[model samples]
Target: MTRATVQRWAAFSDDPGGGNPAGVVLGADDLDETGMQRIAADVGYAETAFVMGSGRERGIRYFSPVAEVPFCGHATVASAIALAGELGDGPFAFDTPVGRVDIETRTDAGVRTAAFTSVEPWIEELPDATLGALLALIGLGPGDLDPRHPPRLAFAGNRHPLLVLADLGAFDSLTFDPGEARTLMDAEGWPATIIVLHEHGAGRWEARNIFPVGVIAEDPATGAAAAATGGYLRAIGAVTPPARVLIEQGRHVGRPGLLTVDIPESGGITVSGTAVPIG
Candidate 1:
């Protein structure tokens, strides 16, 4: 069996211990699904990115410990930075299961950063019954929702139900049964339940992603969800066009990370972050 080289990286934060950790496998052409799963499990990160092919024509696959996901934002960022370190900084295109994604990497003031433009995103209203069930399962009521941002199912590369909470207190006190949440997510074909708290300042938000589908209780920094949220806000006219938003996540879980989202009037959303090697 040909061995695959796996490197650990923390995405969305320059500090290795403060961001979401991901495993990046370069030269992964020799690995199959089973091999990737095993490697990801051993790495014990939320997600692992396997890169095949070369240059801008890369084929990328994302695997959690248990299963393969169509796309992963933080892992993608980590993969890009890893590639940049070895192949030099420039634009790269990855063919993901969902669609083609374009990423660019560069270094500024000694910090390497990567920005990815997600596939076209859309929003749909969550069914009342499903929304009710989700709230009940999470021990939250409709009243806890932020009046400005209504509940909606947002999709970029994957689907997640976006719930904007009323205050930091509600967001901080969120708790749910992982088993039940996983069951619900799998049955509904949803990857995460994104709970967000909008801060007083413009373009500032705090988010938590409950990712039971990946067998992860929570994701510190989620690129896909952040992109989806930016699209959702644009669709709902909650934010003006050509806006840039900063998302703070994973702090509550002790892995603080930052995600910057740029939303245009139309088309793909851009999510940017820094990834550093976890030595």
Candidate 2:
């Protein structure tokens, strides 16, 4: 097996304790599936990013401990920051399974900001029964949901199910049984769930995720879900035509994050965020 070089960074916040941590392995053109999975599990972050190709542009892939997802926002950010630390700043091409993405890094001193766009987007309809079951697993109900936004599954390079709560009351009072959440989500074809309480009039929102974790529970911040939420908001008319929404997440988990997403009137969504070295 070709042992790859790895680095770690936490995206969306400066403080190591204030953002989602992700693994980055540059020039990962030789590692196979088992090696990737082993590295991911050992790092034990929600996801890890591997970059291949070189020159001014390259390819990237994201792997969770258990699976390799098409795209991962935070990890993408983390990977860019990693590249910037060694290669200096500019725009680079990230060839992901989902599509070829562009990342522009703006570096000041040692801090790096990785900004990238998702391939396109799509939305999924959530049924009433699924809603009931999900809420039950999370220990929330329809009453806790935001009347204006409703529930939906959204996508920007990957799939995400967004759950909106009525107010800060519902947002601050979040609780869930991780084991049950895993079982439910496993059946739902969703990788993560984003529970949000909107505050940007209609377009801005604050959210957090509670992943099944397979054996455990929790995910500090989820990029795929954030992208999906933006898409859903646009589709459901919650966002105005000029919809450029910001999603704040991971604060509760100490990894405070901000995801800026632009939802177009017609096709795919663009999600952007920053990443800094936690190494």
Candidate 3:
């Protein structure tokens, strides 16, 4: 079997050390699912993106260390930047498992950034039993929940349970059992991550994504969760139309990443970030 060339990139930050790392395998037409899984496991990132075809449009698939995921945000950003490096910065469309995601790449001052529009987003109420179990797993109680934003399951490309924390201290001091969370998440069909957020200021939020199945306990920057947050805000009427929200994440993990989320009056949410090569 021909070895697939893998490119390592850190997404959501121009600084390689500050963003979430992802593996991008361009020209992966020869690699099957088993090969992709093996490569993803070897790369050891939260997720890796495999691309087939060429030019502005390509077929993309995402895989975690253990299994294939429906969609992934940071990996998509990394893949877009990877393509831009070879094909020149411009618009690119990906035919993902969820749907078509359109991305635009621009280079300014020698730093390339990418912005992607997520699929149609929606929200649903989190069942009480599941909420209690999740809270226990994450070491949080119902009292710690922020009343401003109710608990909900937000969907952009993947399903993420959204929990807003009332106290910034509690949000920052979060600790959880990764093994337990992995079982729960897998059982509930939540292969992505659970998003715990704190609204520190108006239009500014601090997020923590509890990703149990991966090697890391928490993801520094989560594009899918950020997009889901935009949907949660819209579904609950937390923000006015044409609002811009800023999400600061990964500080707890020591690799901080800033994700820019744009919420329009209706339709898909747009997430923008910069990626850099990782050694």
Q: Best lDDT goes to which candidate?
A: 3
Candidate 3 ranges beyond 4 A from true positions: none
Residue pairs in collision within model 3: none
Q: List the residue pairs that clash in candidate 2.
A: 18-255, 19-255, 120-268, 121-268
| Best-first order by TM-score | 3, 1, 2
Give one digit per residue, the lDDT tens place, for model 1 in 143-261.
98888889999998999888888877877888888888788888888754454555646778988888753446888899999999989989999889899999999987899999999
RMSD of each: 1.3, 2.2, 0.9
Weakest 10 consecutive residues of candidate 3 by summed lDDT: 211-220
Candidates' C-alpha lDDT: 0.88, 0.75, 0.93
Q: What value does the lDDT take at residue 242 in candidate 1?
A: 95
In model 1, the clashing pairs are none
C-alpha TM-score for every candidate: 0.97, 0.90, 0.98
Residue 236, candidate 1: alpha-carbon lDDT = 92
Q: Which runs of model 2 end up more than 4 angstroms from their true locations?
A: 108-111, 200-203, 214-216
Query: Local error of candidate 2 at 266, Å?
Result: 4.3
